[model samples]
Target chain A: MPQIAISADSYAAQFAAVKRTAPLAGPLASLRDDAFHCFDRLGFPTTRLEEWRFTNIAPIVEVPFQAPAASGGLDREVLDALPLPRSGAPEFVFVNGSFSPDLSDPSGLPPGVRVRSLAASAAGGAGGLDVLTAHLGRLARFQNHAFTALNTAFLRDGAVIEVDGGVVSERPIHLLFASSSAPAPVLSQPRVLIVAGAGSEVRIVESHAGAGDVPYLSNAVTEVSAADHAVVDHYTVVRQADAAYHVGNLAVRLGRASNFSSHTITAGGAIVRNEAGVVLGGEGGECTLNGLYLGNGRQLVDNQTTIDHAMPHCDSHELYKGILDGRSRAVFNGKIIVRLDAQKTDAKQSNKALLLSEDAQITTKPQLEIFADDVKCTHGATIGQLDPDALFYLRSRALSKAQARQLLIHAFAADLLGHIKVEAIRRGLDALLLERLPMSGE
Target chain B: MLEIRDLQAGAGERRILNGIDLVVNPGEVHAVMGPNGSGKSTLAGALAGRDGIEVTGGSATFKGQDLLDLDPEVRAREGLFLAFQYPVEIPGVNNAYLLKAALNEVRKHRGEPELDAMDFMTLARKRMSLLDMDDALLNRPVNDGFSGGEKKRNEIFQLAVLEPSLAILDETDSGLDIDALKTVAAGVNAMRSPERSLIVVTHYQRLLHYIVPDFVHVLYRGRIVKSGGKELALELEEKGYGWLDAEPAAATA
Candidate 1:
């Protein structure tokens, strides 16, 4: 795969702006410098790279997007109506990559659980400073990914959640990184780090939603670490505005006997790339990755997932679905790797796409590498329109042709919602699909 | 009421239902029986407006309107229903939703008020119980992962809930055991009224003993070869349809 040539001049202006607005000392400042230099060395990807062959990020790279201002002038009612943010759940809101304490609520967090601002925690001699520095930027590699490098270079504020050993959080944590832009196109890079300690269980919902309709870019990075015997359920929802651009990366690691599952839903974006990498680093661990992407009106959603089984007695299951309407396009590239020592590893992957129009399209590729002899790995990809039999069946039940089509489209998405655990998230997804699935100009 | 005047149709290049003319009055049970490849299913498909069958000639009228000219759903809302021989399995769509939406569509066409979820569920449960169907099946996806008997029972359950004026059963008792057949027949029998009509299509003469003209009509090679009273089914069962193939005059019926 050929790489894009990145000169220092590409990010020189943004790097200078970051240094002037917010400069850090100690390991933080050095980490930022290294990440910036790495980003400068390895610039934005082009279609030449095999991973980005189908999705072009030129729309994002061409625009000169300055760092966003504060999240002011947004209607509280409008902000309240974003759907991804739930009431009565411990909520944390971030505007344009800056943490908004006024809009956040962590009132009901139980004992041994803490939600702290990543920047504030990084700045002071924080209570969890060692934990932050140890795991931050560790799982998500910046050496090859320019987006991660850029996110790290500008990652001064985000949400850091820690579940102490033996703690169980009953309430799901909702982190809404709402972005609004008006005067100029801005770029918001938000980072989230979650550390679930030994024997602890936690659920987190990280949503990056566009609060305004103006054209902007949102690049987010989230890292989740599950210790021995810990359980973590994570959800990442990215529903941007019509003209917005988005790229979200999630990196997770599971320790011995830990269970980790992540549900990713991408409803709206002009050009969206969702990348998730999970590694089973210890024996007897189980990991599940579920995703559904809905696109319409020239929208392109690219999903890439990697499940790495590094130890024996590990199992991983991945299922990703896509619904494309109008002239939109979708791509799924899932890679699963089992190391030489990882015997008794069972893995299954399924990627299915439903095209609802003549111009809609999908491209899927599955890459699996298993060195172990006693491993079972299987994968299948299906691309099809709404089943004619199902459509006829529904229509024969007195549903109109349009209603039948919508029901099948809704069924394609509701099938994925059955796997989503959070009630609020499930309701939000239902509302999102109801709002977006009818965009067919027919 | 349905009136078919020399309806000719087929799947593709091969013609089936060649000059099929039948009139079904209200409060009547007409059994259309035939051997395999005799257009029993083709007739059902053609009448239901299924795309597989292309009508080449003739016409069908239902309730004083042109049935052949309407869409499948339109025909359905106009009180026409066809119980499929091999019901399609649709996942992620529950039976309650399907039946409720279907019932609402029919009711809406009749200018009747729609039923809410509670009222709809009550109606669905009552109808399902009458068919001996499990209430859990109402919440399950439409015939998905269901047994053959269960699938057939679900079809009757939907018919009972939708309350169509003309119900066409195309081989409804093909794969059913004796008990399921009785339960299904009882369900169908329970819905019989002076204002409703039935066109029971099957190959076996055994089903009529339970639902019992259901007038028996023997179809062969896409045409009705014989039509008679209830005693005809017993004679066909005793002598078999091979006797009809031997007779040249039987095709004129």
Candidate 2:
């Protein structure tokens, strides 16, 4: 393997360590080896690459992050202290990238629905491993993404879910990944694979958070496959520690007449990057992608999304909004691709950022590449501060200047909040966003 | 209840209001009439403590307190309201929510118990019917997508709800049809009480016919050069402001 000089020594040592301890054989082992080779060739991307132009990963590459040690003990208090609602849904908790059965509740799940740890299933050669192996690495390609390659190289444990055909899950499944402080900075790769059978409907809530003020790197990858006529609602909430680095990749494939929607809410992180790629593989498929990122202090948040219309009569809509305060920075890149054969394709994308301070910055790019003449595609972006006239109007209504600013900011974000269909998730996000609003000076 | 002494204010380098003087007591409606660029809106902005309209000279007192020394919201809490000539459109903020929040703020400042959502809704619905406003307007964004006349009527509807002690209607009659003008005038007339005062600032005498002003002052070149009873508005309307421009030197001297 050609060793790329960018953070070569640290990654090489880490890869060697993982290869020695990773319990894998047969095809999975070969998959890991291939992924490790790909990562070795590509290394950590620099700003020179167009995909990584806006977000710089120097901090992540310079640090040598060993695989986190197995969690020793379960902290019930920390788990309970999370701001999430107790909605009686089945929850799977993972600490330090290792599943903690004591902290997970798998009861109340209907028949034909399975929620289990990938490590457990892969080790025992369980029946679900067949489904896992078929769809895990199929959707998320590691050819161009260094982070995705790294995650696949170290993917030993994560949540694996499958719903049978024609079954509708009434309650959502919650996957909580909590990272605890370690003596040294650690790296955790949590892999998630979800497959909904034909005509099934399901909702999943995935959250990544830190236990305390510890610094860590969380590289996560999620692959979803929606069979013909299936519907899925997926929400990923990233509330990492202020000192944490988080990079997540989501790849989804939709079948004929299937519907898929994903909401990625990024509220906390020192440096965060969320990349989502959706493929309308079958005719009449529909996809909706919405995101909200709230940045304060010196945080840097980046969202990159791509929607590929590979078939005819497919539609996609995307909206991403950002609220930046202090000296924070944000980046949004949305790309919509309509293939030549994908006639009658409909797609729209919009990105808006509200800067609360003069120093806060945002960079947005919306691109549409249409190869078919019969397709209709539109994309636009906007960055601005609060409207002065709106502020004055609210002030005239007896709201203080700070109150007026807060209300307008809330209104800007409420448009995306309205897309969340889950009540508990919606309410939780609303309260959290309100609490995170920066206090204005009189 | 409201007093202004040689009030001089302007935005940036251009002075809009120069040495203006006016006074209005409780239960009285005073109409300040002048042609365009006569600083009519500047007078209203100065009274409501709008930003960018700097008070370069003189003072304004409402209920014995310096109104210019307070913030816009503080002035509002102190029972001073200015109906904007151009009501701003604030999208995504429900009209009922804005009115309820404003009412509660004013009540809280007076140490009175604030109204709950149910109580505020009941109160707002009553005033909405008074102004002949539709119930759907309350659920929409504040003045967003409303017609020009509806926006004007909404402003008066807010005034009725807040019940400020001193109301400065700044060109509230500028962009309204005759029927819509009558609705707004009736809403203002309904709010008139012995304990409250109104300053009707307009460029035309048509609105004065409905909400008849007790006193009419003709403001020329930044100063109120002529003060008379309600007939003064009629006289200016008949002869136009061209006559006042020639006699301003004599009036100022």
Candidate 3:
């Protein structure tokens, strides 16, 4: 392919060039080359696209990003300072996108459970290739988002784990992905493949942290497949990055009688876009998605989700809430589709946002597309400020003005956080969110 | 004691309280009755230091400080409360938690030791029982999904908990049925004491029957056009406010 004309230093151009470098030279190279071709054919999405009307990717497309640091990672002391999950919890650590065995827990893995980085899987014939080739980028169509395709094409080091049928894990597995934004505008693509075998259960916690003062972008894609009667609980948390950009995708394919739930908590990052897609490929499958985003200063956070039901007897429920202050902006787009053959589908979606400042802005869209004759689908979106009457009511009872406003916002965000089935994780995110409030305004 | 001197206040550009004068000494219950839109609620809002009221030319003193100069919470701290006509509903905030936070804030301002959760729970339970409020209400979000009767009762429940020195009930009887009204009135009557005063603002004299007023004032347009003893409320209830409108405007001026 001809060399791209875009800025060599920009994130968009650099990502495009990475795709051009990977080719079908060998068996291992062929997989990379195929992903690259898929990514090249589908470039960055624009506002003109129907699914991206409310989101304008022009600003993200113009910036160039260097690859993640290959050698030195963040200071160990700083990593310890971060509010990570308990150390005893089964953990997998990724330093600057590459999985580090020395920093991970490999023992006590359940039977049929496999944990390996994408880099190792590239060199050797491994577990995720078959599933990766069939399902990767299938739900999160890259034709619309160049960024998603780019991540898929150049994905090097992340995690790939498969659970055996009928196995249940006692301890939760945490994926800690951090990047050193030393070089300005560093770009990291972390790819993960999760397979929940039939009748198995697992919980995955994915978190991103950075330790550089300069700006950078962390682009990631995680694809999950839950087999028949399998259950998966996933949580993605991002926090405390003042000069960074994060674009991530979480896609899931559900089997018959399977259950999937995801909780997303986003408190920090200069700019972030979290995309989640779920395809209910079997009957009697259910999914629940909940999210909370608290942004201040000039931070911009967007959450876009889609749930597609292609079989009968499927159900999905989604709720996302945001609290925005200062000049921050938030966008929420949730779409649910019931295909013609997906009879008896039940879907409900809601997005609500509270703006605490006159300068803050929010855009929300809840969409439902149903082709099935027997289905129940509903969607709603609301954007407003804290109710003045409620504020005064709390104040009259003796809470200070600031306390009242903060309490109300917390209560608003709590509605979603309460849905987190995990106790430790819920409490963990709650403490972090409380300490972050009045963040920029105060 | 509570005092007002030629208090001229208005909501927006239109005037409401025009050159009004009233005083409520400790242990007294004063009621102000007028027809619809006669600035009765405006007086309560102004006295409680709500956001929209414009005090063009007047002074309101609660205890010994300027009440209008304080914010709503400050006014509440200084022993002033306004039972709103339509209490706001805050979802996800426990009713009991909200009450304790307010109580603690005022206590802190007064240099009192903060109550622990157990102490506050005991105190709240006692007050809720007085208003016949179920303990379940304390666990639910504040006033969320409450019926009109329940909302009014909740306001009185709060009044019993906060125990302000001077309480202003603004149209508290607007949506109550006879039974709920009696229960609410009884809650107010139970809270009445020599150390506290009450200012009841209403459109009808029905509420005054349960919580009788020491003094009654007739407010027309933005000004308290007439003032008299408690018997005047009966007179106005009998002879509508039409006479005040029929009289020459220049004469009232």
Q: How far out, in Å, is residue B241 in model 3?
A: 5.1
Candidate 1 lDDT at B115 equals 95
Can you list each candidate's DockQ? 0.77, 0.73, 0.63
Top DockQ prediction, candidate number: 1
Of 1 and 3, the candidate ranking higher by DockQ: 1
Which structure is stronger by DockQ: 2 or 3?
A: 2
Where does candidate 1 chain B have its weakest 10-residue lDDT segment?
Answer: B244-253
Docking quality band of candidate 2, CAPRI definitions: medium
Per prediction, fnat is 0.65, 0.67, 0.76
The TM-score of the first chain in every model comes to 0.95, 0.95, 0.89
Task: Estimate TM-scores for all models.
Answer: 0.96, 0.96, 0.89
lDDT of 2 by residue, B170-237 (tens): 99999899999999999999999999999999999999999999999987767888889999888988
Q: Report the C-alpha lDDT of model 1 over A207-312, residue by residue, as the tens digit.
A: 8777555777899999999999999999998878888899999999999999999999888778889999999999999999999998888898999999999999
